[model samples]
Target: MKQPLLRYPKALVLLFTVLACLSLRTVTAQEIRIVTEELPPYNMTLNGQLTGMSTEVVQAVLKEIGVQASIQSMPWARAYDIALNAENVLIYSILRTPQRELLFKWVGPVAPTHWHLFAKPGSQIQLNSLDDARQYQTATVKQDAGEQYLQSKGFTVGKNLQPSNKYTYNYEKLKSGRVDLWIANELNALYLVRQAGDDPTETLVSALSLPDLGGDNGQNMAFSLKTPDALVERFRQGLQAIRSDGRYAAIAQKWL
Candidate 1:
């Protein structure tokens, strides 16, 4: 009877174990690595600082989860590869395509976007279908979402006209007749045309109807395939928290 009086409840021990596991979870959640391409209005560096709608939204989510993230900006292919093969890595604001579905664990719609086809102002390229521009040499940022979409469908790419790196150069190529078509996000296409000192109206001709290109509007925050499922769950929860709290909309409005 005296020994029984000193016994600790089994329930208490289980509760203690659960609490310890949660503490460990919190500690492990702090490390998140984000790899991104310079897709402006989404993820990009401004004035030597990370600033953009997608970047802001991600930061907000990480803050809520008490997580620390390092965002690496690189070529689209490079970023995708990192998120695919590297540990604790993720890629941002990417269009969710079928071909890319099994590569990583995804989180987001931090924002929505539409793809646009850009051509020189004088060009009479009508977009009755994606095939309409088949005759013209389409240029795209190498390994970009747009490029991947068209290339997957057997469209012959003209040259690697990387955009986020330098839109002015691509614009010049378009003007000089080096590239017949350029695929870009609608908002970004407009921004680049204006930035290049070209009449957004007279220099770049966008297709009347933007195409879906088979992806979610904004892109998902993707965790490397090799990441632990538990960690992926935490990231997914973090993203949901932002969306549910309306923080996602607030940050997205800053860019859109």
Candidate 2:
């Protein structure tokens, strides 16, 4: 500048370029807000820490990508809403339904799940089909995938469906004979029954097993639509890498 500006030394220019690239990478690295609900064996609070089958898979995926994120446990509806409206948010153990296909970018099939209508042992509630279930009062979690699926099949809330804020409440309602059936996942229903101090095999019996409503795949990690495509792809690749490297299987074996 004092004289006529001259080109910087090659070494100095290279150093500056490297620094610029590092800064850009640091600034662009997405900060993920990972959220999940207290669905035991999948995502739950254990000794004040989040650890479950789906949680481990998500943690492994983030590790594969060198991302550090803290998983939070909340209500399923709250977690779902955050994942839907916030950038860089991820909700795990989400059922990948046809109605939810275009709502978010998916990163899994983290685990498989089956939906069933559960009833008290020896209860006269017989459900041979989805329509058969419509005649009895069913307990379901509000805004839950299972509830949505039942609603899609013509089940109406306040008439035949009793919506609760938590799955535990639904279970309680079933135990107290307040509801005819409870919509629950096969594994999760067992876990819940055990938590309620009852033998699952003797407490709950499957009345009807619904067809694969989760796009026939499984539960997945869903990211907000506003998240960067590159970031979503990175997570997807990270998941695939973990699956191929045997880490995913190890994690699944830990909980399942």
Candidate 3:
């Protein structure tokens, strides 16, 4: 019994050391989930590849920081929800509105978004101001900034504010006279119309400019509040690195 005691202690120590190392590795390798939506010219899937202005900027930052994370594209509502509630989840091409200021950690003016209420070509909808749009039905994507902005202004869903799952669906709804207007980013509206095989100028017209939604604040890369501050700073510095190196400008020039 006394002779066996020495060997048993040695075996237990080796097992404990191995377990500690494995635990450390797991803790250090936390997953960073990146989520986005198919808002064209910003974030989209082309030929099954995730590429766009915001997507490129985000990818460049990840490379600058020597981090690798797959970007998943989904409906805006679902992506927003995951980023809202999940730990270490990152959302991009998002407008940093006052309503969302404290909800997450921030990075970048990845790009600016010009929000507008669009109408059918030659339609008699004239907007003297944002309030003028109240009487008409406007198509909006679910959980999008435009929809939220409208809701805050008393636009009711299933009434004057018609919410859909996709921006393209709103475009179709506008064209078919199902909705009097479509609220969307100007560049996105044009790209979507072009994708649908129509000239944007001929397909839709800007009815009103909603500057408050994203006029000057610009879009940003955001992380859930629970993500480490040090991790967020790494991304922030990486983003600045790209900007200083002209990679940010190159990506913007390519897509914008």
Candidate 4:
């Protein structure tokens, strides 16, 4: 005779399995997919471990909400793609631009970031307006806000915009005189230059301010459209809980 457990109806077993996967009370770490990019101070790999301001906040939120998830760092384009189309996918430290407003359900304004166009120290690239930057070649990461913003401003690839897959490559290209400018966030510019053993004040100059990407919700934790509203709300509340208890501030103080 079959064991008591096997004797149960197959339909009942499937119902329990479905509930385990779908119900937040029984959701496992592997059920939700978290994705991010190597955006330093926000999200990055340090000594082979993933730990950053936004990463910490996300971890705290998961703990508060009684859920578990592992974060995977990848290229920004790939990470954005996954978060845009995949079910139950979470993306973090992403700029909440107007173009991306409705793309994902948001949680927290993890941190504020300032956008600017950076040029080499003593560079003659003076830009009073975005149109004045039309003649210059700017280095940008593929699918990054910089590239997207430039594209919206009529900067064509292979002409005025040079898009690469890695943020580090932009620095290399700028130093090599291959690109006249590189648009990036203030924190990212400083962190990358410092990481490269160069002083940002001496190596990079802010040529232009990108006000369009600034103001509110500079970066946020977001869930794909396919994710259930309840799950998103749970995370939203979890984030709020961390903020109220000073956990979020602690993480920010540690990194920023």
TM-score of each: 0.83, 0.88, 0.88, 0.89
Candidate 4 per-residue lDDT, tens place, 160-222, comes to 999988888899899889999999998888998899999888899999999888544688899
Error of 2 at 64 (Å): 1.0
Stretches off by above 4 angstroms in model 2 are: 1-30, 214-216
Model 1, global lDDT = 0.72
Say which candidate scores most in TM-score. 4
Q: Residue-wise lDDT of candidate 1 within 50-110, one digit each (tens)?
A: 8788788778877887777677888777777778787777678777877777877876566
Each model's lDDT: 0.72, 0.84, 0.86, 0.87
Q: Which residue pairs show collisions in model 2? A: none
Off by over 4 Å in 3: 1-29
Give a tens-digit lDDT track for model 3, residues 185-249: 88899999999999876788888988777864478999988776767777899999999999988
Model 2: how far residue 88 lies from native, Å: 1.1
Total backbone clashes of model 3?
0
Rate residue 213 of model 3 by lDDT: 75
Better of 2 and 4 by TM-score: 4
Candidate 3, residue 39: how far the Cα is off, in Å: 0.9
- Residue-level lDDT of model 2, residues 92-167, one tens digit each, is 9999988899999987789878888999989987776788887899999887899998888888999999998777
Candidate 3 clashes between residue pairs 3 or more apart in a chain or in different chains: none
